[model samples]
Target chain A: MSINAYLAVGLGSAMGSVLRYSVSLASMVMLGTHFPWGTLLVNVLGSCLIGWLAATASRAPHGKLAHWQPLLVAGFCGGFTTFSLFSLETLHLAQQGSMGLALLYGIGSLPLCVFSAWMGERLAFSHPPAA
Target chain B: MGHGITSVLLVALGGALGGIGRFAISNAMAHALGKAFPWGTLCVNASGALLAGWLLGVYGVANTQSLWLFAVAGLLGGYTTVSSFSLQTLELWQRGQAIRAALNMVATLLLGIAMTALGWWLAQG
Candidate 1:
């Protein structure tokens, strides 16, 4: 990839990270941090978006939007949904003696995210083919 | 500049660098290990979580909000991705590699949390 590709990914990551930070702050104020609702929300949303974008791209390999894959799919969605934080949060909960909650969190997030991505892919594929 | 703006700028800068780093590492991993499995993402997420946990132990989340924002929330967040993991798992399942897909999901979650805990423990001592 060229330097331009790096630049696009970086810019997209910056934007996505900022959005994630904002949502985390908001979630803290509204829902409290006892559970990482913010991370879950972003992960689910990002998974869906990535799935949709990936499906769309597969359908149109040489479409005009192909160039945006690095920025949107890899950078934006990747930055927006963080596995590290999820892991750290789970560890924190376990350390705090909330083993059950931690177990629930660790076990729960995967299926939710996968299902969301599948739903997004289904949505994309279900649409009528472009002319 | 306002405090909030400064914080955001720090996060943006960290995120940009982290994203580039992730992209480079991912590309290298894919080339070396092949894309049959998402070893790239798994490595990134596990290492990122370990780093985040170490930082938390060193800085203490309550004390260094700014540093935490830049390093953990921005850098690690940008480096480690759940979206790619999810999409990859779905693809694996679609390809009829249900066992591999399940293995990827379970391994990632388990390894990530375990690595984080290990990092925290190491940092504490």
Candidate 2:
């Protein structure tokens, strides 16, 4: 990849990570850390956004929004969503014997995030006809 | 060095390094392991989880806001990803590899957590 590409990914990831931090803190305040609603919210939202961006990017003729694909989708959305913390938090819950909550979070994450992405893709195709 | 700008800059710099490192490692892994399975992302996420757990366990959430922003939120956050994992799983299922997709999902969740706990426990000791 070019230096520009690296810079784009880096900058986008930085912004995304910061947003994630804010969301996590807010979620903790609102929902409590009993469950990781923070990471889940961002993960689901980020997946959906990346899906929308990916679909939009794919439909664009040629490389019309080439730079945008990496900056927004790969860098921003990817950095915004995290699987590691989700896993760790779930483990913490389970290890502490909160098996129900752990299972709920684990089972809920995959389908919800995947469906959100699907919805995003559908929304992208719904309006503003693909180029 | 107030909270607003310094925090943002720290996270940004850490994220940039994390993102770059993730790209390099993933590329290297793909080169070595092939793209049939997403071993690269799996490794990255697992290692990121481990480090994050260790950092939190060792630091203990007192006066490490900047460090937390840089390491946990920025570095590990950028290093690991959920969107790619979800998309890859979807793609695998779409390609008729249902079993592989399921295995990937289960293994990632199980292993990621296991490694994180391991790291936390190690740091505690």
Candidate 3:
């Protein structure tokens, strides 16, 4: 990565992280602590946005937007979601064709996603994520 | 930060910082790991869940005021992600990477929860 790359990621990380915080906080307040509405909402929203960005990037494929490409792609999406890793490791298993591992993991994630949020709230709402 | 202009500015700044941080980290992970699976995404989500839990637990006993909220919840949590988690799982399904898809979903979800619990447990202790 060049200096531009570093700057782009830096800029994107700051904005993405802060925006996520604000929205999620608002969601928590507007919603409730019983569930992890904030995380759920942020995760979903961020994913959709990234999907759109990816599509857009593919289509145009040029300009300052392109310059902002990595920033948005690696930086924003990176900031916004860990989807890359999810895709990577899962795919790694897929290539190996470890049906059992893959299938079991996929099924297990359902509760996990909920539980993570639940625990987050439980920690925060019930106890909190420590100082 | 007040609920007025200052709060708005603070919110913006925090979002900007978090956004950039997320982008930077994800990029680094993607590069370091490679482009086959999504080690980047998993790590980010896992870390975020862990940190959020830790911070929340601490805030309960100590101070996680609005500013702290802006920093930790907004900045770090925001910089990290969960959305990518959902999307990637869906993408795997689309590509017919069934086993990997399933594993991806399960591992992230289960691991994420476990991590959150671990973080909380550590904080509480």
Candidate 4:
């Protein structure tokens, strides 16, 4: 409810959104737009990052990473991975009579993202490399 | 200022505003509905998808690339998040609420796509 929280989220979101835009443009150039590889990539990466950050923050409640949860987890991850675009892309695919692809895209994304998040959490909980 | 820079600035501005709006709405929904099921994220994603569909329907993708970048990619993208959805589903499963987790995933995907289709239909008519 504080102004600081809003500012943190806003700034983080700007950075994340810009990164997403760059990735989308790059993916479009490299892979073409037949499939939304860019959105899927971002969503998977963002979910993994959020899972790691959330797990790390939870492990140490008052740690430095916890302090930046609003910015990094909520703002950056939220802005970087978009559900709206995913939904629209699926809809467009279906509209274009690519129903199988639409169904696959819509149904496939959830489990993949969740698995990525789970893997990220496992990575966080795993012991750090010998230092 | 070049076209690329201008587009980036627009996206940044839209993203910032959209993120703030999402934060406010999420907090409000959590407060109002309690945090048992992540109703906030579902609401945000569904609504954002609807808006994105409507915008695309109204403007068409080929004609307004800049507006698409600003509003759909920036604003709606910032507003609607798969990461939160994925994390929440994983948490639900970890907590042994498998049914709730499944429900959340199905509800979000169905509602989002349905809303997007509805928005497009409405815009067309």
Better candidate number, 3 or 4, judged by lDDT: 4
Clash pairs, candidate 1, are none
Instruction: Give the DockQ ranking, best first.
Output: 4, 1, 2, 3
Off by over 4 Å in 3: A25-38, A63-65, A75-131, B1-24, B61-67
Q: CAPRI verdict on model 1?
A: high
TM-score of chain B of each: 0.95, 0.94, 0.80, 0.94
DockQ of the candidate models in sequence: 0.84, 0.65, 0.19, 0.87
Query: How do these models rank on TM-score, best leading?
Result: 4, 1, 2, 3
Compose the digit string of candidate 3's lDDT tens values, residues A7-73. 7765665566555546655766898543344544555555556555544444556645555765675
Docking class of 4: high
* lDDT per residue as tens, model 2, A1-131: 67777778888888888888789888888998777889999999998887777777777746566447768866888788887678767877887799999999988897778778877878888978444
**What DockQ would candidate 4 receive versus the native complex?**
0.87
> Residues A60-105, candidate 1, lDDT per residue (tens digit)?
8888557689999778988888988898888888889999999999
lDDT of 3 by residue, B1-125 (tens): 34545554554565557655555566688888885677776777677667655655566422235665465544655455655555556566557786877787667767765665566568888
| Candidate 3 structure, TM-score to reference | 0.65
lDDT of 1 at B93: 98
i-RMS, every candidate?
0.8, 1.4, 8.2, 0.7
- Native-contact recovery for every candidate? 0.78, 0.61, 0.39, 0.82
For each candidate, give its TM-score against the true structure: 0.96, 0.90, 0.65, 0.96
Kindly report which residue pairs in candidate 4 clash with one another.
none
lDDT of 4 at A79: 88
Q: Which candidate order results from sorting by lDDT in descending order?
A: 4, 1, 2, 3
Model 2 pairs in collision:
none
Off by over 4 Å in 1: A129-131
